[model samples]
Target: MQIPAGPLLQTINSPEDLKKVPKEKLHQVCDELRQYIIDVVSVHGGHFAASLGVVELTVALHYIYNTPYDQLVWDVGHQAYGHKILTGRRDNFISNRKYKGLSGFPKRSESEYDSFGVGHSSTSISAALGMAMAAKYKGETDRKAVAVIGDGAMTAGMAFEALNHAGVADTDMLVILNDNCMSIDPNVGALKEYLTDITTSQTYNKLRDDVWKMLGKLPVGKNFTREMASKLEAGIKGMVTRSSNLFEALNMRYFGPIDGHNITKLVDTLKDLRNIPGPKLLHIVTVKGKGYELAEKDQTKWHAPGLFDKITGEIYKKKFDLPQPPKYQDVFGHTILELAEKNEKVMGITPAMPSGSSLNIMMKAMPHRAIDVGIAEQHAVTLSAGMATQGLKVFCNIYSSFMQRAYDQAVHDAAIQKLPVIFCLDRAGLVGEDGPTHHGAYDVPYFRCIPNMIISAPMNEAELRNLMYTAQLDSTNLPFVIRYPRGEGVMPEWRRPLEEIKLGTGRRLREGKDVAILSFGHPGNFAAAAIRELRAEGIEPAHYDMRFAKPLDEALLHEALLQYEKIITVEDGTVVGGFGSAVAEFMALHGYKNDLKILGIPDRIVEHGTLKELHRECGYDAQAIADAVRQMRKQPVSEMTIPA
Candidate 1:
């Protein structure tokens, strides 16, 4: 992709510069902005189509409203790339999602334009309303707060919760419902455009003002004219567009189903909405990947295609030096498809991550069995539990970070009920580039305290399959969790014949008498590499792949404690309450005193980078583990230090 020759866009460093541009020339500016985004993202590889989808909306909002003061809170932040670019990050946008660079999502610390830091979806409405209510409390009655939420994000319960409050508060705020996929009504045509112009005209405005004044006078009667005025507005809106009972029933003044791409119409609507106040919801219909033809056709795949040619729209084929193993998500997708073929009770569920989790394969193969539950994680968890009660083996796939949203449901609905819902947690460790909010760093520790839960992390693709297979057996009654990392599995030929790994058990990969290193999940693979280096130095260390974090291979751990008398536990998650802490509790309970050290992510947030970089920072990389073992052996365990 060639750099966009954005003459107008080049001069506009910030929204302040955007305000200086003539309203009539905004369309050309928008075209240049969209192309600029394409040029940068095609090379840099951040969120692609989402930013493309909301170009005109972003332009119109910034052009119409006074941002950094009026405060436009973007939902999810993927669609806010245009907002970021217009708000003075355009020149530095190439470094987006890079290590210690600009965050992919909206971050409050990054810029003042980002009023609310957003990474998780559907929090925009709640955050915006809080700002609105705060503005009201501080007596800034004219301050405007707007939430630009996607139709996909609206499926979450939190969005509705905020709407429910905003509707009743009668606060002067706007909720822009960005309907990019599903349409409440067709885009406003020429006829609707004429009606909108007439409604905004001087003669029509004077007539409406006269009618409102007369109604105010009739308000001498108790609750009469106020009710009549609402009915009048509803009746008028019913003829103009589809009457949205959802937003309207909550007492929000509903106005739209407008053409989001039509910059003239968007500017007019937003300009009019500024004066007409009190909880208004303007539903604008937009096409995802509007300008880019290829992206518009396949919005989902193009949502975050790593690196692609801007002109041809072809994803750059990664040339690996060696044969590449499939992603862990593909392993889960294929394994579940295979399992479903064998068992009639097998079913799949994902909360808006069918494709991301690779469950879309099963979705295509068995549409009846597999379900895409939208962005409702809490509902997805309880729904799986409900399915489990009916004797169905539900394989509910969710990202580890997303599962944090449904933690209560996992505990109350699944664990407390002792339901056999197989939770397939993808991205169970440091997910690079998405940054802190997206890192899968807390699943093991979070679920450890819950009863009737079995948390297992597989070291490779084969263990993932066997563990998944083991969870489906008729004997399995408890809620099972199988967590694996984001990238490719270590094993290339991993789909071996299904084997049942015994519960509460672990397997030894290396043999030693001096030091025993027990590792869990994908981090155990690092220990494998570390052991190879140790052996080259004629110092062999026992390496145990402790598969289950919950039922910690008591018999194997007991034997290791007696034989080696020195131990270390490593995991991909935090050390505070994670796998290492579980082993520590076991030692405390049984009174087995061995010189022990724990190595994993420390008690702080790990930033975005490659897994190798992050693993080294957390002191669980191959070299770090080798160094730790040598230090533990040479010095006392207490004297040995691990990088935080």
Candidate 2:
């Protein structure tokens, strides 16, 4: 079905073209843009509500500014769909988040208008400040830099750190706070409350507005100079808002708690702010899913409601014939709640990803015990460590890619202290469609080298449950990591009785004579499928599920090594310093000469695509694993000997 854009939207091929449109027609453009987004995303899936919320702002920014020249940096990229469409990507918008198609986020390589690439939150201010500083250094006085950041993004410490620096840097830049009070989930923390007070305070707004009008009416002669007018306005703002004016305190001029959905207001505001000298901020209040009635009501559910019916608002789902296997995240969610019930010590924590990580299951049932720590990964880790000191079992669930931000905290606060914090790493492998920034490829390698860290991966739902059970037991002392993939696990009947898995151990799934295949995590299922395929070819290979990456199961390694001379290691993470590398290091340490092949994500940036596509591209899918086994069968196996 061809979804036609609004007549006005079709005419806008670029920001230059947008500037050509009459200012009176921008509201129509915003409406058309919002409807077009709904039409396209309802068929071709990507992030939904965020872009819808920013439609007016997107149109206004392009219409008012000389973009590409006046750079606009969108924080988190969820709101950049309209920006992309206006800036020469309108026709290809249907390919958003598809394999070899448009990226879901704002990528500099994708277009000149995308001033900076962003996927992770709270980075726009720093990036825009850098651009502003560069422009200043080059004496480009006419160039302007604007960072459009959400209130949810403002919760991160990095955002404040950038604000602290940009305030004193004296660079000419604008930070537009899109405060819809959301970041995938509803915004939390003191900042949310502070922004709320600023938005809702009628007394302050009235005083400020009255003073602005009074100043405008004042004479511009020697009696009331422009500088005098500016000083008067500053004094009134500081007095009216009192200590609540955070941006003013930071030495940046503050403007607005205005309706972001007002196209004309946004256009006028941006035009005026473009000429304002030094640092400044504009606070715009808009609904997250503006213009879409259903999306407006439930912002979180519509955040990325993949492939919905735009008319009926029915989200599409694969109709399974029977009960399907649960997602790894759901299993984690339910399991953590069960663990919390059985053990009073267990508490849950996630950094603004309760829904994504499935911690909302626990948070709903056990509100006091579970916490959503608003986009602060480092703080989440350290907070978990603090709870551990009180003998509480903390399940700090975070996305694999997001965990990178908390590495220092994990090392210093948890690992060094030997705090038994259970880190449930969701989306641990090639998370389809989200692309490079979101892949969970490095956790295995990065955490393996940390002292006292027990890094493990589960082959399926049962193992995941068992691992969770074992990690929370009184016997387990060190920091534990349970990394799993993005989507569904293999077992449909996943609700199994929990059992304690032994630490630093592995189980041989199959016994063979010709070769051995050792796998870590959910990739073990791929290995199983490959083994089934190879069996028909008479290639009898042994299979072992090596559960732990940090603590090598020497007994299992010895058993496999003593029996087979040809070995293959598979994982869902980067091959370098990953599970395969750990196995290789063990072999080298024991002086075992085996013809080995390492198969997993390669040491490179894998782009956005389906899991199957990325897995095949990375050469670790079932077919790839089968091919590796077949290739090894043709070669003569080197004789293996144990070290004296």
Candidate 3:
């Protein structure tokens, strides 16, 4: 139980240093790295179990491959912490997933070793393929390309697509399928069964190896002998295993259901494969939470543990520091549970974000009413649409960025059919630490353009709760979307009780004469703060919180135009086709001569940083808004400062 100090981890600063260490000392380094991860994550919560599971895999890959020069892409990037520690990031691991610190996922900008950034699931194969193909095109044959994807990530269709392409291209690439037999939840589908079949094949490997050895002794030409060996291996594998030869069928060599935790086995197998020709797949069987007994015992809860006692491995609980109610998502969970209690037709669905969306509470309260549909966002959307047709009130909760995956489903199935399904989009803004891929910056723009969809952004938890209730009870015969930001809701003394706000209407939070600022969703609160700051400068700017994005608040907007010469629109989503664009489009059509400015997310992929940093970068923060307005008033049209 004694913790090792300093120089053990210090000497191993990078992968090169790791290579110099004797093989015998690897277990010691892994032990230290695992304990170090546990210590840091206990204080600053993050994806724990995943990193722990891949300790040896990380070590093996770094030991075998020339990383940074050779490309290593980690799918979903949640399990790359161990890799990070081995690749010169151990010192910064303490600040992992925290505000203004290291990201939870692999970031290309963070280090040279992280060849491709990934936050979404199933991107490793495609990214690795790209790097491999690029390497081939550039004639860089000396470098290796590797993709480490999870068994859960393998379920995604994109992963299969990459596999199919990689197999046919005959590119020199290595795909390590880390089969832990779980996603956030237990994996589902025919593919999962196929993998189970492959992993459980008792005699397939034995017969194939025996046949290869026999073929090795044949007195034939080298090319013919190699082709015959491959064919014989396939024929023997087919006879013994009825499961589809997915990778082999696509023309890639397949290896293992090997022991993923066995560092020696992993390193040896990788070393052998390094000399092999063409595309290859290595299926490594790993446990999700490999080391810590508590994490191993309850993999799901420990997937991302909060501050916990190292001895008992139990999370440390504390009372809330604020007098405010629970988060908007938490409130939605409670509300849905209550609604389901009365209406048996109610069902809750989430696309692999049960905990983040607060659907876990509902799942616990009424297991039948709530369901986790894995990482299939598109499937979840249409599935909800299917349930709605049966007269069921389906509440589909997903993160704002994730809902992008279901765009076609939203348009084709739900909106087109006008199903009464409630799409609750959580984290609908610049999510901190997780960065660009995880940001909820594009949902408003993406969803606003779709027909038969009513999108609303609530300012506080009470409003969010009411919106959910309203969406459920509305006989409008259309799909409804309620988007909210991550974390706690704003505290206000004059908070109103839950009530249905009229569709397409906006409430004037503050009345002023010179200018009007129209804000949507979470940014509305910041707009109000900016207004107060403007007032101190004798600029009494008006503030209006638009509840609905789709409806456009034409009446309120028209009224504002009549009273004010200058207008600004602010939202948390992209300005391209979002609330600002909606306002600008309306003003232009109406031939309003007033000068206008729009504020929202920019039209580029942002990187890993805190929400505050992103907002400041995008000019969505309160001080940024105040400065933008002040600058706009003082300068001409060409000289006015506008968000990029």
lDDT of 1 at 363: 86
Per-residue CA lDDT of candidate 2, range 30-63, in tens? 8999999998999999999999999999999888
- Which candidate ranks first by TM-score, i.e. highest? 2
Instruction: Give the least accurate 10-residue stretch of model 1, judged by summed lDDT.
Output: 182-191
Error of 2 at 636 (Å): 1.9
Predicted candidate 3 versus true structure: per-residue lDDT over 550-614, tens digit per residue: 88888898888777777888898888889888888887778776778889888887665667778
Two-way TM-score contest, 2 vs 3, winner: 2
Residue 92 alpha-carbon offset, candidate 2, angstroms: 0.7
How would you encode candidate 1's per-residue C-alpha lDDT over 1-644 as one tens digit per residue?
Answer: 23543899989888889989998999998899899888898898888888888899999999988888898999988889999889988888887998777899889889999999888889999998999899999999778999999877887889989999999987889999887752111222232343345334454445445665777676446667555786775665545443444578888887766778999989998999988878988878788887999988878778888889888888998788977788999999999999999999999999888888999899899999999877889999999999999999999999999999999999999999999999999999888888888999999999998999999999999999999999988889999999999988898788799999999899988789679999999888889898899999988899999999998898888777767768989898889899989998887777777788899888997777777778888888999999988988896533322212
Clashing pairs in 3: none
Top candidate when judged by lDDT against the true structure: 2
Residue 292 alpha-carbon offset, candidate 3, angstroms: 2.5
lDDT of each prediction vs. the true structure? 0.85, 0.92, 0.82
